[model samples]
Each structure stands twice: as structure tokens, then as C-alpha cells.
Target chain A: MAAIMAKPSLKTLKCTQCGGAIELRGGHNVRSIVCQYCGSCLDSKDQFKLIHKFLNQKRPFMPLKIGASGKLKGILFTVIGVLQYEEREAGEFFRWLEYLLFSPTHGYVWLCFEDGHWVMMHEVKDLPETQVEIVSPRKTRFKARDKTFKVFENAQAHISYVEGELTWQAKQNEKILYLDAVCPPYMYSIEMRGSEQEFFWGEYISVKDINAGFRIESFEPATVFSCQPFVVSPLFEALSKGALIASVITLVMYFLISSSGTPVMQHHFGNQLFADGETSKEFKVDKPGSLYGITVHTPNLKNAWSFFDVRVVDRDETNKLFTMPTTLSFYDGYEDGEYWSEGDTEVVSYFRIPEAGEFKLAVDGEGGTGEEPAEGFSLSGVNVSIREGVRLGHYTLTWFVLCLLAAAPYFVKYMLFEQSRWHDDEEDDD
Target chain B: MAVMLTCPSCGNQITQITRSPQVLVCPACNTTSFLQNGRLEDVGKSAILTDIPSIFQINRTYRHKDWKFSPVGRVRYDYGDGWWDEWYVRGENGKESWVSVDEGEIAIEVLVQEGLNVPPFEKLSVGGVLMINRQRMTIIEKNRCTMIGAQGELPFKVIPNETYDYVDLLGPKRSSFTIEYQAGGVECYKGVWVDPFEIAEA
Candidate 1:
């Protein structure tokens, strides 16, 4: 329960310990006020009597001073108190500053600043759904309100310093166990001290918003925080979507337009007798600048090799339009007590027809066996075939590569960002 | 209808502003009195209430969002750590309600007398859950509050310096439920938390 004084009046009282003037801003609800001058903790209910003297009280780095009023989300809150906490584990120390904000309407809220990050937290009464199951020794999972949370840290924290007014008597060096669970941009925390446990829900506040709310330009976070949500750029999102749409369109076009070309020429040559050359009958290329598919096959060549220097000649036989060179070979034997084979007996290639006109196939090549001919085995001949207006498979392969190239950078960046957020979980697991 | 009564101690005319108020403090002499069977009975001097800055005053109307009510009387209670005030207010519709102010938080509540199954105060603890009128509510605070003072006119009897145990439960959307265990009987109030900043003098 909270005490209401919609219009809070300042009560100035002299400190019993040091006689320094102390200002109380929390109305009757303030139980303790620390003298900023002499570091004396006084009981506000008992004539400001000295409860404890916090000696050597050095002020930590604070951006918001006491009695400073600022409006957050259209509600005005005054910075009434500050509590600095420290946690020590594995010979490492972590410190944070918590500013107690009081709104005449919203009761109490906390703004925590740690490592250049800020979170605004409000105490809640409803318990999370799953409190009995522990995901691991250091982590847990629960659902509260509407969000699912993954426990980020469970550690014991100690109060290192206190200033301004507090609702309860906050002692120096008090220790309490706190657990923090996060669902990006929001965090659920539980603090346990003896028989009392308090729950607080928090939201990550960006530096820009904090600066605007408090009217101070402070800092930028250099590391990922527990509740910092990953924001995707609109440009990147549009680019990724565009790439996907392009891929689908390319696939549909490939399936709709792809076809094997009409046969134009076919030729066969005798074994070891085509050293001069061979020519095919005349054929007409109907479409100008269309694609042509050429295939060379050595049907009777076993454990032997063949090479072909092919060219497309005009009907007048004066000028050659294209030159395509290819080799076909087949070999097999037992090596190291294992059978092995290399090279292919047939090969295919593609070329663009220069113009729509009459043409003829000119082929010249050589054939021979690598070793002495096996018993009753001999090389026979070579077969050559050509077709015009063909669509090759490499067209789809090229489009696929282009699509992947467009989206890979943003994908890698997103993955790295997610990894950085959970980087500390690996160490905790270990 | 308004009934006029005379203060026993001050000999001053006291106008009973509302029909349901049982207790009235004389503005002239600060004498606390209660009406029984249409006659004023003296209950001695009213407890001294210290002057503090507050949002509400007796006989003043305040508006919160769309609600319009005038605070007719007040009862102050002292608990552990701090004190709070329960202002008995009458809305424009002639329905009575309570505006509880504690540590800058305010709750506008109405007395609930039917279909409530409240357990004993000793069985309740902070952070415990309770089902009231089929709605799940969480008990946020349990404390014994002592009646310290009274002012103006109140609907219920005010026993000066009498202490009673009470538990406050919170429900969804800032709903508040309070169960007060008094010596006479158990009383319950159901309401919603109102933002103090939204309250304005009407």
C-alpha cells in the first residue's frame, strides 16, 4: 500500500547527527532520509534521529539528482532516492545504479543504469506461471502476463550505497538474491530477502528515450543487454523479400520456357580413320541468335580416349561461324586391389547461333588406347549430334547463385546479432 | 432530506449532510458524536488530526476521469511504517464510496455486503491468492491499522483508537479489494485503483 499526497510538499528538517539541513520529498511515507552532507541516516518518524552513519560515502556517477522531476510516458515522476548495488562473482565485480522514481499517481518505479544501458521497472503482484521448474542450475523459464521469459541471471546482490529518501529502512551492505528473466524489451525479476520476495517487471529503455525523458544526453550502450531487442532494418527486410520473390519468378519462368532444341545435324565417324575430317548434311537455323546444344559420344571406345575439334561452317563453305573443342574418354582397371574409373564416354556443350541461316557440321579428331589393346577389344568410332534453340540447365543454376548472393550479408548479420545476445549463456553453461 | 442537530458540547447547529452518515464531528468544537434512533450521542472529543498536504478536503468534490464525487467525511488509520486516510465520498448519483489514499496511491472503492466468502485474517499473508466473487486476487499487504482520528460525517461508526486487522488484495487492471476484520464483524470493499494525478477538484 502507498500513501497519497498528490501534491508533495517539501519538508526541511535538520539532521540530528550533523545538524545539516535535509529535505524530505516523499511526504509521510518517507521512513528514512539520508543526509547528503554528513552521510547520516535519520529516522523521519522520530524527529530525524540518527539511525546510522554511512561514513566515507562517496557519491557514485549519477545523472539524475534528487528532487529532479521528469515526465515519463506522460506521467511526472520525481527522482526521490537512489540505491547503488554491487555483485561480486568469480573474482569479478558488477555495479549498477537504481533511481527511485515517484509519481503521485503511479506509486513507485525504478530506473536502473548499468554499463550504459537503462531499464524502467515497476513492482507487480501477480506471480509468474511456472516457478517450480528450473531449466538449469543458473537459468529458468516462465510465462507471466502474456510473454515467455528466459532466465538470464540469478545472482546475489549487495547494497553498496544509499541516498535520499526510502520507503523502508535500507541498511548498508545488505545482501539479497535476485533473479532476472528476459523476454526482449521486457524483463521479469524476483528479489528474495529472508521470508519476503518481491517481483518487478521491467522494460528496456533506449538511450534516446531516456535522454528525452530526463533532458540529458548521457551515453550509448556498447554491449548487448538482457532486454535489448534486436531491431531489423526496413531496408534489409525489403531486400530479403525482394530476393525471395525474384527466386520464385525465376523458377516459374524456367519451368515454363525450358525446352530441348529441334535436331539440326548428326554424324558418325569410323575408328582411327577420321584424322582428315567429316562433314554433315546442310541444316537451317530458324531463330537468329538462338542456343545450340552439341553432344559427342564414343560408343565403341573402351579404355580408349578420343578428341574432337568441331566447327560450324556456312552453307557456302567459305567462313566458319563457331569453333567448339571437346574430348571424350573412358578408362577402367584394377589399382591397389580396387577397381577405379575416370573420364566420361559422352560430353555435351552449348553455343549461341550467330544468325538464322543454312549451316553444316565439320568435325575432326583422334582416337587411341592408353595401353596395348586388350584381348578382342578394339576402338570403333565417334558420334556427333547438334540441336538449335536449346535451353541449358546452367541458366537456373546462375539465377540461384545470384539470389543467394543478394541475401547472404544481411542473414549473416542477423545471426551474429543473435549470437552476441546469448554470448554469456555459453559461459554460464560451462 | 437534511436533518439538523445540535452539538452537545459546543451548542452549535450541525447539519447532517447525508442520510446514511452515523458519525459527525462538530466543526465548531471538534466534538465527535454519533446518531442512534434520531438522537445525537456524544462520543467525546475527536482525535486531533495533524495538518498535512492532501488532495481531498471535507465538503469538496473531486473528479477522476469520468467519476465525480464529493468527500463528505474522513477516517485516518495508522499502520506500520505510515498512515493512510479513507475518505467517505458521495458520488453524483447519490451512491456512497470510499477513496483510500496511501503513499500517493488512491483507490476508489464501494462497500460490498453480499456473496463474499472472506477467510480469517490470521490465515491471510502477503503474496497469497484469494478468490472473491469468483475473481482471483492477490493479497499484497496485511497489517493491523489503528483508527487515529475522524472528521466531518462518516457512514459507519468510528471508535477512536480502536485497532483492526485488514488485508488488501489486488486484481487485474488495478482492481483493489480490502477485507477489514473488525470486532463487530467483517467488512469488505471492492474497487479500482485511480491515478492520483487524474483526480481534480470538481
Candidate 2:
């Protein structure tokens, strides 16, 4: 086994004036000693030198106890801690919170609730005394819940004045302190402070004077708790769910309404040609008056014509509303060299009924017997039914049927081919 | 070349008439000076004076135990006759000094410890040289003089040389003393140096 080496003992030096001993470690030689107890300066030869005397100067290794309480976003919180620090070469106290809070990982977002609204803020920088500027759109007031408690910000935690006793300890002459507290996220802001001007987030209160001997101080509460954690209620959840359902329903209705077809009425009157020499027998439907309840039958002619022209004129020749000319066409019809030997023929066209009136109907050789000649010879058929114009019930029924027909394919796709499992997860989470 | 000494009272140049003269009378001032044995007489009138140039150079490596402890501190003084100098020391516990001569030509150097207490010296005096060891302080006072080695001394002057059987003086404690150099003329002062290592341990 290899032999273990013993560690060298550190040389300890004492100040002549104050009897303070500063231990030098690692066997390093020191040329001077400053008494932390009396602030006296000593040379290597034991000579006393009167250097500059510090007045109202805080000890670099002093521990400060701070107490602060305030309301943030409707929640009241309190903080109590002992801050440890030292003097920089520039004679400024190097405060820890001033540097730690502003670190990228340490920076916090504060949300304060007041006046029925939540105010968010980020800490800017700290100034001396009990003041700090928030990097928010406006300034916010930070006050303790009780008048007896003191609230401070932007002040040096280690050097700020304190009304109570505090204690601290560190490794051998090294400085250390203790802190304890609970604070709300909203009341906090980030700021740059300390001798090096680093950033930190927190409020300041009292600074305790911990003499050189101790390591830990007694813990105490800074302020009373006044608020509880905020929890969202189920009422809000229900209202939000209702709003979402309403929106979805409205969107679906709009899609269905926009995709539905319009109502149309078509009439047939003439013959259809399949082959050049092969012509379909003429077929026609003619009705007098409003023609709302008339039905006409024709011989089954394959390749039959599906178009018809209707004219409605008043007795004084003023062009009656129900006697206006109308054209009709159909979807299922004869192809070239084929005849529409059909049962119920489908018709598609536009028609309008202007007013209540009687109308005469006639078909002759694919053209109606009228002053305006028809292009093809029209079929002959005549019938009459008295009433107003086309029935509103019929138009409504047709629109309903068309809508059902159009939605059939989409319903099948959604149920089988595009079925999603997302709905189940949403339901389970809810 | 022959060595000559100038008489301070009459400003006349004088030379040794013999190597064993007990006393030499100054012809210009009619002053008589006695020599101890054959060695040059220690008249006690000619104080070891350091010029502003030499003092400033030497002080660059001078570290004290107390005042201006940190090298980041600033030092400024006027060496009389409108000659002002400012110095900025860098690094921790280091020593540096500067002088403004005719508004140009500044000299600077770092002070490094050779052993425990001895510090290296550069640009000391006017063409004179100095070398300090941990156990001795040596000075080549002039170009022609033999190197005077003050041996067996402590880094600091706590006890007189005669008290200890085998004692060495280390370097002076930098924090104890504060030195200000001015230049109406040159003057040298001596004082006791102390050892801070002893005082701190005590």
C-alpha cells in the first residue's frame, strides 16, 4: 500500500490591536493583517499603522436579517432571511440577492392581482432605501399587510439597518448567513444591485449585525400570511365548454346550409332526336290556371325531349305572372342513338310565378302553338288545375330531399373511412 | 582613470595624495577631514541621497505591509520643481510607480518575489545596480565600487545586526511605511524595518 501524506497545518496570525487571528491556509506567507474585530492595521514587523479610519462602515462579512411582506395578485406573502455580503475593493457591499435574482435562470415573472385584474411585472433595477422600479408598463406599490411590518426594496440586505439581533457563521474566518421565507410570484421583480451591479429579484427589509463568532441565527417569521393559492372554479370551465360547443354547432350548420341545393321546377313539351333518322316520340305536360296540382302522363319514348317552353299572358296581353315562358331540362335522359323509355323522369330548370292567374297551354310539333315560333316540333298535351302558383310545400320538400341526397356521401366518409380516435381522448380528459 | 571627490563646501575637485593619508586638507575650503585607518573617512556630512529618477524606479518594486495594500490603488505625488508623477498598480498585492518627465518617456516593471522575501530590482540609481537575495542585500553603489553585500540579514529589520549570532534580514514590510519623493533636491532618510510575519504570528 502507498503511504498517505499528511496535510500541512495552516499558520495563524493575530492582529496586535484587536487580538483577531486570521488563519493563513496552504502554508502561504502573509505580509499584513487587518483586524476584523477592531479594524486595526498591522505590519509584518508588529508595528501599528494609522491608516484611513472607516466611519459608519459596515463589516464586509456581516450577516443581515430581512423581513418583508406584501400582496401579489391578490395573494399575500411574506419573506424573512439573513443576507451575507462583503465589501468590494470599490468600497461597495457585494450583496448576493442583488446578483442572484437577475441571473437568467433565477429571473421570475410576477403576477399581481388587484382591482379585479392581474398585473404582471418584471423587476428592473434597485435603488437605495425601500424603493425598486419594476420593468412593467406602470409602477406598482409594494406594502406590507400590516402596518407594524417593514417592507423594503432596492436596499442592501447585509448593510441595511435592522431593529433586531441577527447571527451568521462561515468556514473558519469565512463569512456565511442563513435565510428563510415564503413569497408570492407576483410581488417579486428582478433588479440589478450589489457592488458588481448584478441582477436579482426580491424585496429588502432589515439587516442584522452578526458578530464575527457565530455561524447560524435563529429563524423567525417576517409577516403573517393573508392570502391563499388561487384555483380556477368549475363554473368558468362550464361556460367555456358551452361557448366551444356553440361555435362548433354554428360552423357545422353553416356548412350544411351552404352545401344544400336550391329548389327548381321543370316542364317538358317536345320530342328528342337520338339518331339522325331515329327521333323520340313527342311528350308534353300542359296545365291551365296556377297548375299546382296537375299530373300528365305520356307514352314512353326512349330519347324523349326533356325541355319545355311555357308562356303565360294576361287577358289584356299584359304578360301574366303565372303565364310567363319557362324552360325545363332533365338529368336522366337519352344518350346518342338511345331513347328515354322512362318511368319517373327527373327535371331540372328555373321557374317563377309572378301572380295569381289563368293560363292556356298547347304543344305542336316540338313547339308550343304561339306567336313566337318554337325551335323543335313540340308534343301535344293539355290539362288545367286552378289555384295560386307553385305550392310552397312542394318547394320545401324538394329542398329537404336534395339536402339529404348531397349529405349522404359525406356521412359515410365520416363514419367509416375517416373515423378519428381524438374524440375519445377529449372526452376522457374532460 | 583616477577617482576624484568633489568638496561640497568649496565645489573644488580633490584627489587622494596618498593611499595611507590620515587626513586631507581641502585647498579651496581649508577644511580638514580625517580618515579611519586607510579607508575613506565617514564624514557623516555626505548623506546617501537618492535622485527622483532612482527613487521612483526603486519604489516601483517597493511593497509595504499596510498603506496602499492593493495594487489597484492609485498613487500620485509631485517631486518638486513642477515634476509630477502618477502611478497605477495592477494585479493583487503588487507594486508599481510612474513619473512624468518632460511630458514623455515613462518606465514600468513588475515586482516578482525571487525567494520568500527577496524581490528582483531593475533600473536602480543612475547607472548603479542593486541585487537582493533572501539572506543578503547587495548594492553596486558606483561603476568602480566593489559590490557591497549586506549578508545574514532578515527580510525585515527587527533586530540590529549585532544581536543575533546568525540572523538574516528579509525584505521590508511594505504595509508599514509610506514613502513620498519630491525633487527640489535629493535627500535620503533611514529608519528601522520590521517583520510583519513575526507581528502577525504574535
Candidate 3:
């Protein structure tokens, strides 16, 4: 689809209308030349005959003048002409520019710039695909990359300025209604005049790349395009893949470490009571292990929660080294107005011991309506179960959390893709 | 090359000579002769045109697509605000084709014959597709520019400034298409984008 262009040659032709010095530098193949002085369009083959008189407007971005050379896809090209276009809707005026590029070998291409973003496009001989579904009253559906893109912009674009040689009869003030279907950096455009339509396809070019092609060192695009894939895009992709891989790795590690958990104890201390400040039970550890598990169960409280403050401590260590107290609450609430509840009436806690020793499983003495738990709410039949092993449930829960975090990058990617669809287009539900 | 013919207006033998000059000036009577139907028909008085800078010179051959084209003649059109060039190129096979360079694009063009039916500009639209020679193509741009004048040699007749309407179509591969509405009803043309580098001296 791409090839080298013809070598450029310069021949001087004076403008017939203005006698202004005119230069035709694209190649002898150039058909038309515009005068810089008197603004005359003339045939490049012979003496300049007045095709039309034109008043040149200032080139929009003057640095990109005619005859400027650049490389696209590593192929050299010369800017043979520049045309500026403007349009208006809803009392707001929008403008852009298209630079005609000539590749003596490849023939011709166009560089379009709007709000500082540039797109290199050419007439596509092959149409991508079309859809039968009508997107809007005035627009149709186009297919690209297995996705359907709706016509987002359809407006009349007018020529604003022109300079250098053109292959077609390009005149300022000529306007054509063009429809655009955009999928981020790539856009499919159609220009309709009368009964004929033309198709052109293009991709967004970063300012950095454009500058490098044109060899412009001091340059920055007017506005950074939102659809312009960020340099960190690849980084996000790498991280997303890494996150998924890490999630799986973490899950496997979770299962492996959790497999080492051996149930050291599962004794349920049942119907325990504390008449004093705190009633405690002593469990002697024959061997110490990596982790501890505590499960407390209470009698169903109809629709109430019973709270118990429990602690595990090594009696051998006077400093109460393992005396970490934790609150265990049990609830068995019935479905009620304004809210519904369904949960187990049991809770769990864990403690780790450094060495084998005698440890005390202690429960606080009841104070709030302490006797018989004041009727409806009670902790009298409360049972406490303890186990010593690696905490498998902790690893499983942690693995799930890590997986959720890992999925975040993909969501971000999706949102960014959606945002790019609307970046240069006016909002439309269609 | 100058073609000798009798001026119908001045009734004088005149010579229309120039390198592919489409509109020839009869030096004997100042009669403007246009090449039409294998004859130089006098249209009006001739206007002396100034020479302007062009990339290609006469007698120089350049390559475009599979054809080697040496620009022989050219026409310029004015669309009110600006003007562009359309060149007549003679190929190695002795086939004549038009290549238009406008706003920096080069397209190989040919005259569409008469009697071809074309929808009105109001009815057709951009992003719309049309069937040509049984192949589907997309319409990208519609143009309306008036022919102002021409120079050098040409295959068809030309008026100094005749306005016409047309549309640009694109094929699937890399072909350029154009349909023009002129006095001859409709004309269809197929063209392809050409690069200078790909084109070489023939």
C-alpha cells in the first residue's frame, strides 16, 4: 500500500494574474500553481493562464510551509501545498488545516491538523466495510477492526487557505460536507459533493513523531489529543498482565501455604459463664505452631447481637505477651421492616504463639444486664473453639482482595477507550 | 508542435503552435483557437498569458503508476477563493490521461463519457457508497469549481472558464474515482494517488 515517492524538481513559473513570483516545486507532474504575488491559479504546463484569482490567507501554522520535507512510515515526503479549512455550527466556528504532501514515488498524501493534533491520511482505494444498520438520520454505520463505529461528525468543511502546487483544482471557499467515523487514532472520513462521495482513512500522528519527520526541534502540538495513545499505555498493558499473573501466583501460593495448616485443637468450650469480672479457661499447648484460630458460638438471640471480649495469653510469660484481646460479636437477626438480616451466630479470632506453653483463653465478665444476659439477649451457652495451624481462610480472603485490585487496571483501560471515542467528537447518543 | 489550420473567423491560414498548447493563439488575426473534434476551432480573441513556475518542464517524462507520463498540457480552475492545476499527460502507450494536483494531492483522471446517469448532489452524501463497474466504492468529496483557462496540448476541447460539478470517489484498494456533470451529461473517471518518488524520469 505504501511506496516511495518521486524526486522533487523546481521550475519557476510567473503568475499571469498578479505577475507575482510563483514557484512550482512539487514536480513537473504538478498540474496547477498558485501565484504568491497576484494570487493567480495557472496551468503548470505552459504559460500561466488565469484559472482564477485568489487572495491568499495566512497559512494557519506557518512553520509547516510548502516544500517542507518529512518522513511518514520512514518514507520521505514533501509538503507541496497547504490548505486551511473552517466550518461553523451553533454559532461556534471550528477550523483545521490539511497539508498536501507529495511523494514523488508514492504520489500524494494529506496531513490534517486540528487543535494541534495531526493525522496523515490518503484516499483509500479499498473500502473497509459498511453496515446496514442506520446510525442516524443523516449518518450510516461503518465497520473497522471488528467494531461498529457510528458517524460522529458530519459537517461542511470549507477551504480557508491554499499555497504551492496542487494536483486537483483546489480553490478556496469550496466546501464539502464530510462525515467522519472515528475509532480513536484511526478515522474514516467521507466527503460528498453532489452525487459522488470519496473515502479517506487516516491515523493520528503524535506531535513528537510529526516533528521528527519534519525535523522540527522546537515544537509542541497545540492540544494533546485524548485519543493519542499515551506512552504509558504499554506500561498499563504490561502492568495489567502482570497483575493478572500476580493474582494467579498469589492464589497458588495461598493454597500451598494454607495446605500446611493442621488443626491443632477444635475443643468447643460450651455453656461457660463468668460471674466475676472475667472468667477464663486454661488450655495447655503440648506443642507450639505457626497460627491460632478461635471460633465462638452463642445461642440464637432472636434478633439481637451478643458481644464478648476474649483474650489469649501465655501464662508462662508474665508480660502477657500473647494477651491480645479481641471482640467477638454474634448476631441472629430476623428479617425486619426497612432491613433484612441473615448471618451465622458464630465469629472467629486467631492468635499466634511463639513457643509451647500454657495459654489462657479468657472471657470478660458480663456487665450490661450481666445476669442471664437480661432475658432476650444471653451469652450463657456461648462456646469458644480454638485451633492452631496456618490461617487458610486469611490467605483465601487476602487472595480474593488482591485479585480485585488486579482487575482495576483493565477497568481503567476500558474507561479510557470509551473516553477516546468522545474525545474529538460532539456528544451524541447515536 | 504547431498544427496549421485556416482560421474560421479571420479566413486566414494560421499556425497554432506551442508545446501541448490547448488554446492556441492565431498570430495572424489574434483569433483564439480551441482544439475540438480533431480541429482547432476559433472561440475568440486570444489573451497573452505570462509564464509561471512549475515543477515539470515540457518534454520531460515522469512516471505515475504503471504509466510513464510526460505532461503535455494543463488546465487551471478557479473555485472563487483559490485555483488548482490539472495536467494532461501522454503515456508510453500513447494514451492521454489527466492528472490533477490540488491542495497537494495527485490523482490520475480521465474524461467520463456522456450519457452516464449520476444522482444529484442533494441526493448523494458523503460516507455513502456507490457501485462502479460492479465494484463498490465510497464517496469522500464532492467538488464544484469553474474551469478558468488552459495551456499546452490537450485531448479534449476547453472553454476558457466553464463551471462544472463533480464528486470524488475512492475504491477499495487505492483507486481514485470521479464523476463529472458537464454538457455531455455525465463522465466517470478512475484515478490513483501518485507519489513523486515513485514516479521517475521516463
Tell me the tens digit of each residue's lDDT in model 1 across B54-170.
Answer: 678888788998889988889999996778989988899988899998755788899897957788999889999998777889998899999988888888788889999999989
**Second chain only: TM-score per model?**
0.95, 0.20, 0.74
Give lDDT tens digits, candidate 2, residues A311-344. 3334344443442232322224467968553333
- Candidate that scores best on DockQ: 1
| TM-score, candidate number 1 | 0.65
DockQ, Cα level, model 1:
0.14
DockQ of every candidate:
0.14, 0.01, 0.07
Q: Which of the numbered candidates is closest to the native, going by highest lDDT?
A: 1
Model 2 misplacement above 4 A:
A1-188, A194-232, A257-260, A263-430, B1-202
* Top candidate by TM-score: 1
TM values, all candidates: 0.65, 0.18, 0.54
Over 4 Å off, model 3: A1-9, A27-31, A43-47, A55-59, A132-142, A145-152, A233-240, A248-294, A298-326, A329-346, A351-430, B1-202
lDDT (10s digit) by residue, model 1, range A106-186: 667888999999998877654687662222344467787668888888888888888988877777787888888889899
Output the worst ten-in-a-row residue range by lDDT, candidate 2 chain B.
B145-154
lDDT of 1 at B125: 91
lDDT of 3 by residue, A1-430 (tens): 1111233346665567765666565644567776655556787655557678667566465658777888986767888877778899889998887888876445577898777788887765435566522224333566854556556667787877777788666676877877777666777777775555666767778778888899876356644453354445777777777877777787777776673345444444333443432434566566566667777666543444455666565564344554444433333334554555555567766667767877776565342323244433335566666666645656665875687597786867666766664554434644
| Model 2 agreement with the true structure over B1-202: per-residue lDDT tens digits | 4346554455556664222334433444433345444333323221111122212231123333433311211122222222222233332333232221112212232222232322222233332222333222323121211111111101111111111111111123211111212123221212223221111110
